[model samples]
Target: MYTIPKTSTTDMEVTSIRLEKELKDRLKKLANNKGYQALIRDILWTYVQQKSGDYQPQLSNSDIRASLPATAQQEERCVLTGKVIRPSEGMLLGLTNNGDMVPLSIDSLED
Candidate 1:
């Protein structure tokens, strides 16, 4: 839920990348008042944090608002226990406080 901040945009170097016009338009629509560049930065940060070995999302069972049963369409990692959920495995999709649905091991909620 929280991450270590590397540095502010003030200390960052600028780099350019090209995107399809339609994609850029969609991003603009979604970004709204925050602006597309900031949105892009946020998306990159989320991806990097998820892939980082040291990243442990600051979440708890209490932070999960609900748990909905689901099946893994592809391999997924349980957010609570960091266990691999293979394709077709029965699992639970925990809806977090922030309204994100994350995979959970089948027995994560079991006593």
Candidate 2:
């Protein structure tokens, strides 16, 4: 007789997300034996994989530099914070939800 192997999910990091009560109920109804957590995790993993496959960071250094706004090129006020950053000061460029690249101060960003 062969025994089934147990799968381990212990190595995965746990995180919480807020969802609407109605949506939660709907997910629970559809989850059946898999449970809501597993269903949500599978959905998120699929989404991440799909999005990752679509992403291509092929921009050259000169292309990136040319894409920046005049203010960012001059290293003036930060796009997100509006705080003045000198040209010599260290700054980070981040992509916004609108797909536009914006300059930000390193201090304003979270790890």
Instruction: Supply the TM-score for candidate 1.
Output: 0.66
Candidate 1 local Cα displacement, residue 1, angstroms: 4.6
State in Å the error of residue 91, model 2: 43
lDDT, each prediction: 0.80, 0.56
Clash number for candidate 2: 0
Encode model 1's per-residue lDDT on 1-111: one tens digit a residue.
434465677898899999999999999998899789878887777567666744455667887899989999998777777677899999999999988999888998765
lDDT of 2 by residue, 1-111 (tens): 011233467966788799999999999998899788877876675445334543223232333332322333464444444466677676777665546575666654533
Q: What's model 2's TM-score?
A: 0.41
- Top model by lDDT, which number? 1
Clashes of each: 0, 0
Global CA lDDT of candidate 2, please? 0.56
